[model samples]
Target: MFLRFGFVVGQAGIIGTMAIVLFSNAITLLTTLSLSAIATNTKVEGGGAYFLISRSLGAEFGGAIGLVFFAAQALSVAMYVIGFTEALVGYLPDGTSPTLVASLTNIAVFGCVAIGAAWTMKLQFLILAAVLFALFSFYAGAWTQFDAGIFLQNTGSGFSGGESFWTVFALFFPAVTGIMAGANMSGDLRNPARSIPLGTLAAVFVTGLIYISEAILIGGCRDRETLITNNLVLSDIAVMPALIAAGVFAATISSALGSMMGAPRILQSLARDRLFRWLQPLGIGSGANSEPRRAIFVTFLISQAGILLADLNTIAPLITMAFLVTYGLLNLATFYESITKNPSYRPRFKFCHWTTSLAGAIGCGIVMLLIDWQWAFVAISLFAALHWYLSKIDLSADFGNVTSGLLFERTRKNLLKLEGELYHPKNWRPFVLALSGTGFSRPHLVVFGHWLTSRTGILTLGQVIQGELDDRHRRRISQERMLHAMIGEHGLNAFPAVVVASDYVTGVEALVQCQGLGRLRPNAVLLGCPLSVDRMKIFGGLLRNLRGLSRSAVVLRRTDEPADDWKPPSGTVDVWWRGRANGELMVLLAHLLLQNEDWRGRELRLLRVVDNEAGIDEVRNHLNGLLKAARIPGVTKVVVSKDPELAIQTTSRNAAMVFLGMQPPNIGDEEAFFYRTEKLAGGLSRVVFVQSAGGMRLES
Candidate 1:
């Protein structure tokens, strides 16, 4: 406020001060132009530096910068309070005691700052407008005192007196620092690009002119120790101490208000997008839809904490120095894009291919060269460390909850239409087939696999209703439903066979249980897999049982798909008349196979497995003897397999169709079983076992 304090720098130092003023102006121009360019392309949603940087760079950079912006804004608010109180202290009349007024004013400004930190944009605009007018009056008031020749007198030489060139440079840095205060609010602007550039640049120009004007005006007042007296303006209508203090305080408050208006929204954006998880928990709203307010509060709170521990007086130069590097990075980002000719490099506001930005950085470094390096080092190092951490920690790892897996998957997905050969049918329409229901699931699976060897089916769901229930009745119904559903679903109405579950693990045992006067016997006895260890014993029992039960051969299949996509397998009937059972069943199976396609002679594998040397000799002899009478080609095999299942496995190795006798599961059991002789789930196989009594059966 005093012309005396302006004389703290000798006349010669004012010349250096003028240069400092010019440097600050340059910084403002650069800050404004850069921020404006970014603002136009992006909607200037609040979150200040955080919003602008994140959109231009990415979420990580934005998040880290948001913290810095918030910190700076909060600190400025406190600095405003202190400045206002000091001005009030200076404003008290000489005769009146100033302590009470100074103390009360300090408390008042403190409250005002707290409220301002949490204030709305409309209210802030008012404060800014009022304070701006007050600040303008200072410039107008001082304008009349300005003299061009005073500048010439002060220009003794560069770094005259005890000041070094770098010392003068350091003084200018803080003056430029205020430009960033405006830049931080670009995110809140309606048109960031245009407004950021214009507001920032204009502020710097106006502020720098005012600072220079004040220095010039004060310097010209006198060579006296104090430039202006306390009552000078009141006495002769000249400079007034009260007016000066009030004006500066108002300007400071306005600048602080701008900080509150702008910075936190950047942090809020970071929180929303998760520039970092560490930052996401901040910006909690006090009211409904108070995102901006919440962000501002958090920002102010942190900045206040920082300022309290080491207020602006202590940290101002360090902040300016840290921000110098910040500006340089921006310039470098712009430079890299411009030089690489990357499409994003094109700028709306141009200044010699990014030199304007570089100049800001170099100028910042020059000022820092003379300031407190310890503080400057700490600030710059902390910022650099933060940037490094942000880069190294993947946002996905650290802030993954902010977005969805779908987005990450899509972003990282390779350009492929299909993952693999999902399915193929030679461009044919998808085939439809069917399978029956199951008491449990094993039987239907085997049956479906058998059908799928030559056809495709759709998934079918079946449910059965029984009016009455009891343990015995329930078992009966379950079995009945299984059989009926299987028979109905696979369209086996024309066939006499039905899929059935068996009490015994043996295939022939199942056959026995399924056989009765009205009960149906399946043409195919499908075995999922050998359910018992002694499959050979089961097969032998099946052979012994087949003689009387009058069931038929079995088809065993394997598949991985669900019971859907199944249909009756394709095969040709090759019948061997081993007995009356074989003769009748061959006639029946031949009829069924022929219904689909002509039966080829090669498909007739009348296989019979003989257990021992004597049985084999007898079987070969029978084949020769029976063939002599029939004049038909019949396959006869004699294999030694102590294991009953092995015998079937060996026989199935060469024969697609194995004709053998069918056996009942047990005496009095309506459905009987046939031992499966093949595991050809992907192909077609039929095993027919003729019973001694009624007829034969063929399975695929």
Candidate 2:
């Protein structure tokens, strides 16, 4: 405050400086309230703000901001010490170097912090006394120099030296950035949720009033030229000039000490989480209170680098950007907690609302870009890189975070909205549920389902356990987890579901009837062809049941090739167009498959088998017109064959994948239908028998 007040007033004038202070303070207060809300909602421990954030936002975000916050705190030590050095140099003997003074001041702060937080608190009381006395002296003596004309002249902006309103704001924002000082000491405080809010709010309010009052008084009493050029004008206006000097030293030293005490604790908390292996040793604490001595040493080195820069204005903006980024994320965390309405997020503090937190977040971001777009970009890039790096590291936490809750809430709302919308063929997308029993045993079924959906729609890998729900509930959960792990291992975008019933067929029926939410439920079911006669009968029965439920069925008949040697085929996808009943779904599924990277650039062929050659030209013209109208690229072929099934197998024998139309078996003719399907797909590489429920259209 002592160092930058003149710069802000000189650049933006009195009214602009007051506006900056009020705007910054209001946003800072909102962010503080957000912090208080989160802190009170849970049991906050060591790591202060980092603890609250990591536990709320999850590890990646928390760890990223913790590192940034730690750097800000370390740089803050240099900024404050430099302020103290600036005041001290004015009173020192001629030729005294400010760099040497700043280095010595940093060493002094390090020694005080190393002793422990207890001693630092004791020193803070004496420093506070000096600051208050200095304020009293300035106000008491400024009345004699106050003039109406000078006050009016300083009220409007009189910017000079290439300094705009935002430039001045960048220099002054650090004044209000100390709101998190209390939150950073969360580990050392008793009942932190209570003390942090009460103390931080009070400090912001009181200090904000003091800054506004000082700006008003200084503007009225000091001339524009003097205020613009003089960094130590406060001392000139004070009745006891020496007391003002004492206040500058006291205030700056107190701030440096606070940062010195806070930075190491944040680092220690970050290390204790063991997110990064290199930082593990810093987590080791010594003495009765377990002081972060190693972290302190690291902070000291970083501060020395900041001190080497030596200019307060240059260092101030860097600190401003870091603090703003941290503050914005804090508000965002709180806003998500509130918006998601997670039951566990019940905070004792009620004054804060989601809008306030959102505004605070947005306000911080706008200020960041307004100050310096280039530096803001760099700071944001660094933050994103850290978050990405931390996300890649496998750090598990026992406690729950809000990310899942947020996703659930959003999904719920969208599902409800979808339930109200009208369904149309133009918007049709496959929501496939693949009943692949232990996907590892029938990998072809899972792979086929993935190719059909491939991120354009939803895929759920479903498993059926033939047992009573009471006996298989735990096993069902375990199976579901296994399926989820399988999806992750194979890098497939899908969900997992498991159902238990009294019989295999009954379990499959249950999964078909209930597996999704609202209108987002599965529209198609995929199954692997049975290898045994008994299983083939069951598959025929399932196909009939699916037809009655108005659901499409895709049955995959894999070759005798081993699953481990199976790879996505690079040849053409052949679709045998028998009729519109299953032809549209076959064509659409082929299109979707081609959208995937593995199937990209592969050929698609639409082949039709007719009994005579007389209608071949007419059939070719019809297929070409359909392809042009649908905007789907494919080759058309017309064949005259008395046995259509034989022609299909012979033509697509070397195809990557073949799509064929099928009809559900009559109740008593299941065995006959199974044999026919087995013969039709006899020598094909991989065959998909699609039975569409007539709910989709490719040309729409």
| 447 Cα displacement, candidate 1 (Å) | 65
Candidate 2 overall lDDT versus native: 0.84
Would you list the C-alpha lDDT of every candidate in the order shown?
Answer: 0.47, 0.84
- Backbone-clash count (model 1): 50
CA displacement after TM-score superposition, residue 343 of candidate 1 (Å): 1.4
Candidate 1 lDDT, tens digit per residue, 248-279?
65566665565555556556666777656766
On lDDT, the leading prediction is 2
Report the C-alpha displacement of residue 410, candidate 2, in angstroms.
5.7
Q: TM-score: which candidate is best?
A: 2
Residue 92 error, candidate 1, Å = 6.9
